[model samples]
Target: MGLHPIHTSKSYHDKDELGPEGNEFTSREEVFDYDFYKKLASDPKVLAIGECGLDYYRLEPETAAKQKESFIAQIELALELGKPLMLHIRNAYGEALEILRARPGARGDVHFFAGTWDEAREFLDLGFTLSFTGVITFARDYDEIIRNTPLDMILSETDCPYVAPAPFRGKRNEPSYVSEVVKKIAEIKNLDFEICRTALLQNALSFANIH
Candidate 1:
């Protein structure tokens, strides 16, 4: 039941304030530097390369450029290291898809995915796994996305400290809440809970290269 923490700037700052074990990425800039990822990847505990990708929703145009640069760099690093990627995409799915298509053989999961069925299908076609957080349990739109995607391609996550599920909505999320996410996915996919759980567990293991 190990949790692989996704590193982000806010999480880094929070960890710094709390003085706890937390993964951190300074900015999109650091994501592209091979030396930085190489250093981080040296640690056996760091299993994946990112939560790295485009986020046109929140970023300014110039800043988004940096994000794309970082995203591409991290993708390259994942390929070089033979490690899976933890992608974070927002309103930039098309751009992300373009880059992914350009780089053949790059594999990863798009964490906390929010996109249309068509877009989801494109990702599936690209052979990338799609992960969803608790948002799908409460948001009608997200639930639709969950229902549309196939069970085998789906994975569950908490995106802790962010999108907590229904019962714990508005509370700080944690890895333990991944169960709620799993439950929601099971409901949407109309599959048995245990079966969904096993499949997601296998997907996680395979993505992280953990036998």
Candidate 2:
């Protein structure tokens, strides 16, 4: 069975309560509400707590502290609920690593990982799986990281509707297109396509604790 979870980023979502149509909103809260997250994450369908983390791509000093505040809340939420995390770290690996390192027994996958071998190594050392997207199918961006990462510790994804893989780069993306990402990973790791595919599936299952 294809068991997937309800994934989202509470860290980046606006603090204001969104309207029913999702366009209108209320005044932003001074303190972010972990209670709202706690209710949603308690749902059985929600397997992970994230797509959340630091993103210093824009480097707004004020937002950086806020981002860390939201990130740590989600991290604690994941740990409290006994669910895995799906991190969305970008241009702030060191900070992300520091936060995660302090929390013993935290486990998850770092989605769309775009970091150096050293950075990836630190995450791997924490027993977190590193996930790659269709970005690897075109640019040589993460080829070395893919080559160096162990097959079992790697996960393949498509980041659908964005970053379409090669041979279909200009078109819209979908979950089915993940096959190309898997194929590229197999090629990088020099393993049979089926072997890589199976290992990745196993990793996903293990990451979400779908025994």
Candidate number achieving the greatest TM-score relative to the actual structure: 2
lDDT tens digits, residue span 1-32, model 1:
11122222222234542223334444322334
lDDT of each: 0.74, 0.79
The parts of candidate 1 lying over 4 Å away from their true place are 1-31
Superposed by TM-score, candidate 2 places the C-alpha of residue 113 at a distance from the truth, in angstroms, of 0.4
TM-score for predicted model 2 compared with the true structure: 0.85
The C-alpha local distance difference test score for the whole of candidate 1 amounts to 0.74
- TM-score, cand. 1: 0.82
TM-score of each: 0.82, 0.85
Question: Which runs in model 2 stand beyond 4 Å of their true positions?
Answer: 1-31
Q: Model 1: which ten-residue window has the lowest total lDDT?
A: 1-10
Candidate 2: minimum summed lDDT over ten consecutive residues — where? 1-10
